[model samples]
Target chain A: MIELEGLTKHFGAKVAVDHLSFTVRPGVVTGFLGPNGAGKSTTMRMMLDLDNPTSGTVRIDGRHYRDLAEPLKYIGALLEASKAMHGGRSAYNNLLCLAQSNRIPASRVREVLDLVGLTAVARKKSKGFSLGMNQRLGIASALLGDPEILMFDEPVNGLDPEGIHWIRNLMKQLAAEGRTIFVSSHLMSEMALTADHLIVIGQGKLLADTSMADFIQENSRSYVRMRSPQRERVLDVLRAEGLAAVEAGSGVLEIDGATAEQIGELAARHQITLHELSAQRASLEEAFMQMTAASVEYHAHAAGEHKVPAKAPPGAPGAPGAPDQPGQPGQPAVQWGRSYEERRRRRSSRKGA
Target chain B: MASVPAVLQSEWTKVRTVSSTVWTLVSALVVTVAMSAGISALMKATFDELSELEQATFDPTFVSFSGMILGQLAMVVFGVLVVGTEYSSGMIRTSLAAVPQRATFLFSKMAVATALALAVGMVTSFLAFFAGQALLGEHRTTLGADNVLRAVIGGGLYMGLIALFSMGVATMLRSSILSLGILVPFFFLVSQILISVPKAKTVAQYFPDQAGSKIMQVVPDALGSDVAPYGPWGGLGIMCAWVAAALLGGYLVLKKRDA
Candidate 1:
């Protein structure tokens, strides 16, 4: 287990990490999520004692990192891809040096090499290895000590699909063995697939700490999207049934607080011919964007505006800085529902004008 | 805390596994011996044409080690690479994470590399002296002569110390290119040039190389060189002080800076 309390780091005048406190428990893969420059790397470095925190303490297995007798035997980290190996040295020798330092047996180096599937090229200098190969070598080095805690920063950044699948399974297997697996990535989709629990940060502040399922369920909107040839009758039936139905462009009526099954049965009893009926669940990516929109340091304004035309402006009700409770007043999903109605009214008024 | 022996063993592996260590140390030995032999041969042929002061002050012991000027540069390269490549290749983080004790990691690495350098330096000194003496023919001085063995051993010590000083500087600077940029010109050109200038010679004589080279001379003020206030061992002491200060600075930087 790893615990950080009141961790803070300042780089000159810029606050890189601001009082982050979280615990990564064993027996689960905890995903660290943040946008670029959200202090994820800085936090990881401080955990490893590579960067001195301005004011904080990190305890790995209940002891300070520097105080650990053999740190590698307790916690192993892959900070950046291919950066931890000597370019001029062969992969096997590079790991051997680390093993020797920690007094780990030499045989474990080959074991980790085989574990990462790099045994074939173990004799080759790492400088000549491809990015995928380099990442594998890094993972091999991290696994050299067979530590109980493993941390990886963007491990899947430059990997092929096969490599990605292999790492995903590797982490799951490691976690199944009751090791603490803490990983950081900006890819929400990847996190959704790999992370059992999530500790999210935004602008160096703790945004959310919950399980993967709970985080998505709480922070995102999932509603029943229904379309009927007689859209007016469908809307009337939904309203009569006390369902909060809103017109969601293109003759579709979106009803929250009701399942597709409930909505379909209601439409059938009213003799409304439904053209389409499906549940629209928010993806983890959308949930992540809503949570971190205001804290995104490098906001590509043009790209963001072009891609998400109806995205609410910063400081809008339910935007970042609001409470974390979903479906509450001023929550992202509620504000988005209100905005959709506003947009539809404006479009009809413009036509009249 | 990390075990010192383990750290030392790890550092030894790091140095030996790379090709740069082998190439640089070999070049230091080969260049020093070959150049020293060639110069000794040329000096022997022109001995009769030397002036009175030149003849009086011609120390065969010092002459035999003349190739050190070019050769020490290779030692500098060796030293810089030993510490600098850790930064260049981004392996310092991994190394530090494994050991965690900054003092242990830095000192252990320096100790292993310095031991290798001292070994190679002693062999190179002995070979250069024997080869240069062979080329000198009748002008050669035997190792059995008074002060000859001291000078020979001091020559080896000087070469080893040069490499150690370079390692300290490289660790402080943390980049091979930047350390070489400053150290190469300062050692190769600036130190040599300043030692010859009328007024600058006073201060330049105290420079690490100029002071350290005093140990290689069997005769005082050999070849009409400047008269230093300190004796040979005293001069080496001054160089040792420079190396110590550099290492202390390097330690401070490593302890305080973020990896």
Candidate 2:
């Protein structure tokens, strides 16, 4: 189990990680979802005490990483691929060093080598290993201590399809054994398939913390794509009913916050949308984008501009600044950390423009 | 602590497995012995007929210079491999994470470096001593003489100290290239230049390389001159102080740094 309370880290004036708080429980895979530069790596580093947090604390199994008697025995973390082993050393020797430090028997080195399927290359130098092979070596190093808590940052970044499937199953298997597995990734599609729970962050602030099912159910809004001879006419009618719609290019209007039943009823009343009116369920990607679009910090272009678009669609209960319960004081809105365009597209009225 | 032994074994594996480790150690041994032998043989054949006092006062500076120069080169690399290798390869993170007790990791590396350097230094000193003596025939003094034994053995101690001293610099600089860049020239060129400068010459005599070189001196210089603060042990002590200071600085930075 891992718990973080008010975890914050500031790199000079820019806040790399805001006052973020979340718990990772055992028996499940908690996917840490965030766009690039969303403080995922910084949070993980602070969690492992690799980087000092400016104003918060992170506990693993109810104890700080530094206070643990045997740190490796308590938390097995693969921070980066290159942190695994020296390239010139053989795989066995690398594990041997760690095993020696933690007082594990030397035989365990071979066991992990075999477990990672690198036994054939055990004595050979790791300098020539591929990215996938290096990742496996890193996993072997992490599993060497057999700690109940595991943390990996972007484990499947450069993996092949087969390697991806193998790791996905491995994470689930590790979780099934009641180990707390916290993995970070930028891809919502991968998390949808792998995560039992999701903690979404954008621009260094918590955007959503919920189970996968709840996240998908609560934030999943339906959209309708309309193609008709009179596109602007249908858009104007939908707009009059206060429905949100945007032209998705190629004369297709994507209407949001309205289902097919209401759309068909309105279309029948207006004598329109006879050509096409297809309903589109919001994907995890869209829900993720909607939840975090306002809080993203670093954009590809901007350096220090922290601007959250004001017109982000009303999201589920945990949308920025929303309180946890009715009539309760809501948390202050997170300080925006990115440029205006990267945060939101403002696609509310494309056809008019 | 039993962990100390484990750490040593682990570090030994780290030092031996890498090609740099083998090359550096080999360079130290080969350069020291081969250079000493070649220089001694050339000096003996060339300067065969000198006065007894001239021969007696003759510092093995020429023969010792071979191995010292080579040993210094190898020791620089050896010192670098001990600390700088971890930074280059990023193995220090794994090493530190394993042994979270920071001082233990630093001390263990020092122990490994000390033992390996001592063994190599002793062998190279013995070979250089015997080879130089053999090449000089009647002109060369035997190890059985009073100061001869101390000088011969002192050669070994000097090499080891130089190795440790280099390792200390490596820790401070934190890069093999930077450590070597600063260390090699300082030992070979800068110290010489500093010693030749009339104003700085007195202080330069106490600098690490020059002061440490006193250990290999069998006889005092004929000119009545003020001597360095300490003789053989004092020179080695100066170098030792440097090693301790470097290691301490490195340990403190490493303990506090983000790595």
Best by lDDT: 1
Chain A TM-score per model, please list them: 0.80, 0.81
Docking class of 2: acceptable
* TM-scores for every predicted model: 0.89, 0.87
Relative to the true structure, candidate 2 reaches a TM of 0.87
lDDT of 2 by residue, A86-152 (tens): 8888888878877877777888889888888999998888888898888888888888888898898
Model 1, A97-170: lDDT tens digits are 99999999999999999999899998999999999999999888888889999999999998998999999999
Over 4 Å off in model 1, which ranges? Answer: A226-277, A303-306, A309-353
lDDT of 1 at B51: 83
Error of 1 at B68 (Å): 0.6
- Where is model 1 chain A poorest over a 10-residue stretch in terms of lDDT? A303-312
Error of 1 at B217 (Å): 0.9
- Supply the DockQ value of model 2: 0.48
